[model samples]
Target: MVVVGSGNSGAQIAQELSRTHTVTVAQGRPQPALPQRLLGRDIFDWLSALGLLEVKAASPLGRALQRRDPVIGTNLRHLSRTRQLRLAPRIVGTAGRALITQDGGRLETESVLWATGFRPNYRWLAVDVLTDQGQPMHDGGVTRVPGVFFVGLPWQRTRNSALLGGVGQDAERLIDHHLSSPGPRRTP
Candidate 1:
């Protein structure tokens, strides 16, 4: 099997599939990964305790320090080191059942799994809420429009804002804003 992209999804899929089949992962660049736990505590706990998770996404220093999306909670490095998984360069194209890599490498496989991530598609929105780069213009998910909010957006508040386990804090903040704001309350 051939897996394209090496993010969390790709890495996890390759890891599981390799147990029953020969798997090759094609990645454009090296992925950043961190263990689930460090120093006898969950990494998320450390982030929360140190207040790193609350850093503003729009901070100039944060932008300067930003790199690649990190993959968490996986043993990808060990899998590669033990030869349980094979990693390769980016996939350029496919010919029949053969997958071609950027460096002229090819893999003949019966299945090709594409684990590339996605981007937000706001083209259907008629309002001018997007920036020139096609990203939403908002301060930590709250837009200029009254009562309008956004959540689960990458870097909405911090690096983990878009992660599944990370959206809760942002959601709670949005709920608080909604409840505290002056408005006409309609009782259901």
Candidate 2:
């Protein structure tokens, strides 16, 4: 099996498949990573305690520092160390039952899984709130178009905004901001 990407989804897929079948992971870039635990507590707990998770996404420094989403709570390092999973460069193209990699490596596999991330599809929205790249143009989930709030978006308020246990804080802030505003609320 060939897994494209090295993010959380890709790593998880490779790890699970390695237990049952030979697997190769094609990664284009170095995956950002964070330790699941630090100083006897979860990393999320430390971020919350230090208020790092509450940093505004609009801050220039914050945006500059958040280059990629760091994978957490995964055994990717272990899998790599154990030699159970083989790592290769990004796939350049496909040729009849085989994948050609950037490094000139060819992998013949019966199964190919693409674990790339998702892009938000807001084309159904009838508002000009999205950027040219199709991302919502907002300041901490508050878009220029009033009454349209986007929570749980990647880097919405912090690098943690899109994480499962982290989205709540962003959602809470958006709700608070919406309620405190002195304007007529428009239902979507």
Candidate 3:
């Protein structure tokens, strides 16, 4: 099997599958890899201790941090050295039964697993809270449409805004803003 987009999900999936099936990780670009632990402590502990996780997306430091998401937990380099799991170049195309690569190589796989990540598409919404680039037009999740708010946006308020547990922080702030608005605004 072949996995496309070697982010966290793809790497984890490929690692697990390598035990039962041959796996190829189609890496688009190399990302910095961080071990799950450091100095006998969880990597997150260091991040929290350094306050990196709460950095705002707009700050110079946060801007630099968001430029490339580091691959966490899994060591892709070690995995690539193993016969069952190998790293491949970006997938350029597919022809019949073969998956083509940017280097003009082709891989024949019985299955292709895509973990390409997510892109928020606001085009389907009838609301006018979208920018010309088709992204939600909001100031820290508070849309001009007033009553509407968005949580779980990447860097909505901070680096952790999109995380499952972290979203509550963003939600709490938006609710505070919503309640403070002069009056209810149901439309843009």
Candidate 4:
């Protein structure tokens, strides 16, 4: 099986399935662990620490941390390049076929898994707080998008809020603002 993307979710899923199948991870970046390390742990710890480690929203500094530290950025162990692992061009033209690259050769597979990660689907937002990529532009909980806010991500206003269990605080604050803020302004 082949897993596209290589984020935490994708890595976990790939590793889990690898025990039973010949799993391959197709990463856009040369390595996959960098993104994983952003959470602050080695692959062993990362995969096993699920729920045990605190997961949070991405804050300005946190997001910045991801850019600067990128813990797993250069580590490619998660993706073995040996015959066990192969580096192939990212699939584009179509998802109709499976492409493989190994020992300077190419082939195809019968099964594939696109674990390309999640793209925050914010299409339902009546308000604008997200970037073209659908990610919110905010520091802590303060949004550059005005009246808008974000929390529960990495560095969401507070350290704990980024933790999986801490998201409630961030949500509470945003909800409070939404409830207290005046209704939409009327046109002249």
Candidate 5:
């Protein structure tokens, strides 16, 4: 079995699946914990107002930016300590085969999954308000392009948007507003 992420959720899944299947875990740069919202504020502020400070804020993973802590290490160890979860360096090339480092030698695996997580790909969008990387460049879902808004984007206005459960309401509001408003101008 191929597991795409190395986070808590992915780790748990791989462990369970490995009992009956050979599991390979794809790891990315270690992550900091999700932030706790300050009272009377939304995640946008927590992200924009504080910027680096927010990234440096503390959580279950310890202070956001600060390293040299055992929290992240312990978590990784707990998930990967098992023999079932083998640490493969990384897969190279696009040949549908994986090269994993094991016992000072390279081994091949059957399947692979990109557990790298979500990255915004908005290249098809007709607007320029999005960042170069396709993320909506906005504060609190308020875009530079008026009447064009973003919802369900990571940390869009609140921490809720980042979670699966929180995106529905934001999507509803954005869609409602977009449909209710007039269409774009046409050539006269």
Candidate 6:
């Protein structure tokens, strides 16, 4: 199988599939990776203790940190070293049943898994809260359009806002305000 991405999702999917099948991972670009643990502590524990995960998205420091887009934890490097997973360059196209790589090599695979990231789709929305870029125009999920709130958006309130473990905080903040605001309730 071919996994056409090397981010956390692709790396994880490749690792899982490697246990049963030969897997090749294709990277779109260079990425920095950090181990899940550091100095006998979970990396997220360190981030939480240092308040790095809570940094405001609009802050200069947060902007700088987001630019790195590091993969928090993965075993792909070790797996590659052990020959459990095969690494390849970006996949540019396909020639029939084979994948054409950026380096002009052709790889034949049974299937392909595209782990590329996603763009938010808000065309179904009927409100005016969308920005020119179609992102929800809000301050940490509090929209300028009343009663219209967003949660789980990338960096919605902090670096962890989009993570499942961290989204509860953003949700709590939005819920508290939403419940307190005197307005008609509309299902979201």
* Tens digits of lDDT, candidate 4, 28-123: 664324443535565436533553233333535545444532323333364455334544545543434646443333336677777775545776
For candidate 5, what is the TM-score?
A: 0.56
After the best TM-score superposition of candidate 4, give how far the Cα of residue 89 lies from its true spot, in angstroms.
Answer: 5.1
Off by over 4 Å in 5: 1-4, 30-76, 92-96, 100-105, 168-188
Best by TM-score: 3
Clashes of 3: 0
Q: What is the lDDT of residue 176 in candidate 2?
A: 90
Candidate 2: tens digits of C-alpha lDDT, residues 96-163: 99999998889999999999778779877899898787788888889987788898887777877887
- Cα lDDT computed for each candidate against the true fold: 0.81, 0.82, 0.86, 0.57, 0.55, 0.87
Candidate 6 segments whose C-alpha is farther than 4 A from its true place: 180-188
TM-score, cand. 3: 0.93
lDDT of 5 by residue, 1-188 (tens): 66666765665666677777777665554444343344766544555565432231224332323342112212444445665666454433443364543223344566666655566677787987877667778755667775767776655644455456667867776666666667673233
Q: Give the per-residue lDDT of model 3 (tens digit) for 1-188.
A: 99998888888888899989989888889788899999999987888789887999889998998889788898788888865988899999999989999999999999999998988788988888999999988888988886778889888877888777578988899878887789855545
lDDT at 148 for candidate 1?
70
**lDDT of candidate model 2 versus the reference:** 0.82
Question: Deviation in angstroms for 160 in model 6?
Answer: 1.4
lDDT of 6 by residue, 111-145 (tens): 99999888879978999989888878898999877
How do these models rank on TM-score, best leading? 3, 6, 2, 1, 5, 4
Answer with 5 or 6, whichever has the higher lDDT.
6
Which residues of candidate 4, in runs, are more than 4 Å off? Answer: 31-63, 68-89, 94-96, 100-107, 128-139, 142-155, 158-162, 175-188
By the lDDT metric, which is better: model 1 or model 4? Answer: 1
Candidate 1 deviates by what RMSD?
A: 2.4
Q: Cα deviation of 117 in candidate 6 (Å)? A: 2.4
Candidate 2 — number of clashing residue pairs? 0
After superposing candidate 3 on the true structure, give the runs of residues whose Cα lies further than 4 Å from its correct spot. 185-188
Give the poorly placed runs of model 2, Cα more than 4 Å off: 75-78, 186-188
